[model samples]
Target: MLAPVTDETLMRRIEQFIHAEARLQDEHAYEAWEQLWTDDAIYWVPANGADIDPKSQMSIIYDNRSRIGIRVKQLLTGKRYTQEPKSNIRHFVTNIEVTGREGDDISVGCNVMVYESSLRGETIWAARTDYTLRDEAGAFRMARKKVALVNNDRPLYTLSFLI
Candidate 1:
């Protein structure tokens, strides 16, 4: 059996994971980002609270590994209408807190500020990302990723990449 991680270690790991994910997305390394999840992983962007079931409520995005791959492919292909001319984005993650842990799985919550620039210039958006991670083979793989936007109910522009 594996020993549990200390609170400090767990927090640090969560922060590192968030930063790595942001970097991968900023660099447009979709394949690398996809590798961060397990085979059965789910990425969810809940419209309301994290507790809400995506199946019941409309989600900003609720994708499995295969769906994620398709999204990545669309982004990279330059065929996605929303991605035409492309948008440069930088994500700032902060307030990382580990809320709970059970066995190899840890629950983390953090705030994200994403700045995206296109022909229309820059737009700033904020959201909260709740992550569930599992320690597998001594590395962390995402089990569930839930993004709760402050303006989830508001109309959204087309999303070409993973948030």
Candidate 2:
């Protein structure tokens, strides 16, 4: 059987990766954020339950590597009007836990509170984010990032910007 992780150094590294991701996204550094993901990574946001199959159900945003790149490009080019004026955003990533590990993949669970301000007004969004990070040589890369927004079931304002 596989043993649980008890390495402080390794844990710190993972925490840094997650924190950096939050910072990059908040700063609108799309190019840098794109590099944090693996070539086959997935970014998914389910519409209903967190356990719902994205393929079988409606999803808010479900993107493969190609789509992820395209989305970033659109944002950078200002082609996505929802982000035309851009929203001032800050991310609070907390309650991070190393939930599991198997082979070279590590599962992490985190709670995020994103505060956004735009001409529309101020909004606070909360979600449970689960990430599967794959050890890439000495670094960790995101293999899958699934975000279950607390208020996803209702009519949400334009979430054209990155979460």
Candidate 3:
């Protein structure tokens, strides 16, 4: 049987994972970001109060590797209109709580506040994120990332980057 993860170890690993992801995105390291996920990983930004089932409810963003690839392409390619003047985003993740864990997988929950600054202005957005991380060859890879934004139900503006 596998050994259980201590609270300290789990928290440290979770924070490290979150910070690494933030840094990767901020640096526009799409290849590194892609490697953070499992083969069948799912990235979801759900509408407020919406169900987790992607098929049933509309998600603000839902992506697998292919969709993630397209998004990366759009962001990197100068031909994409949104890339004309890229928006700068900083993600602040905190209040991390571990909900559960199974052999090679862990369930983590946290609060996120994202700040975006551009020539247009600055906007602050908040969300609650749940992550399912699985161990692969002793490294953690995200199996699922669910982000439920507080203002998801309201009308939104353009989102040029991953949240």
Query: Which candidate achieves the best lDDT against the true structure?
Result: 2
TM-score (C-alpha, index-matched) for candidate 3: 0.88
Model 3 Cα lDDT, one tens digit per residue, 12-78: 8778988898888777687788889887888999875646578787788899967877777777676
Regions of candidate 1 where Cα sits further than 4 Å from its true position: 1-7, 48-51
Task: In candidate 2, list every pair of residues with a backbone clash.
Answer: none
lDDT of 1: 0.82
* Clashing pairs counted in every model: 0, 0, 0
Better of 1 and 2 by TM-score: 2
What lDDT does the true structure give each of the candidates? Answer: 0.82, 0.91, 0.80
Clashing pairs in model 3, backbone N/Cα/C closer than 3 A: none
Rank all candidate structures by their TM-score, best first, as comma-separated numbers: 2, 1, 3
In candidate 2, stretches whose alpha carbon ends up further than 4 angstroms from where it belongs are 1-4
TM-score of each: 0.89, 0.95, 0.88
lDDT of 2 by residue, 76-114 (tens): 998777676888999999988888888999999899999
- Window of ten residues with lowest summed lDDT in model 3: 1-10
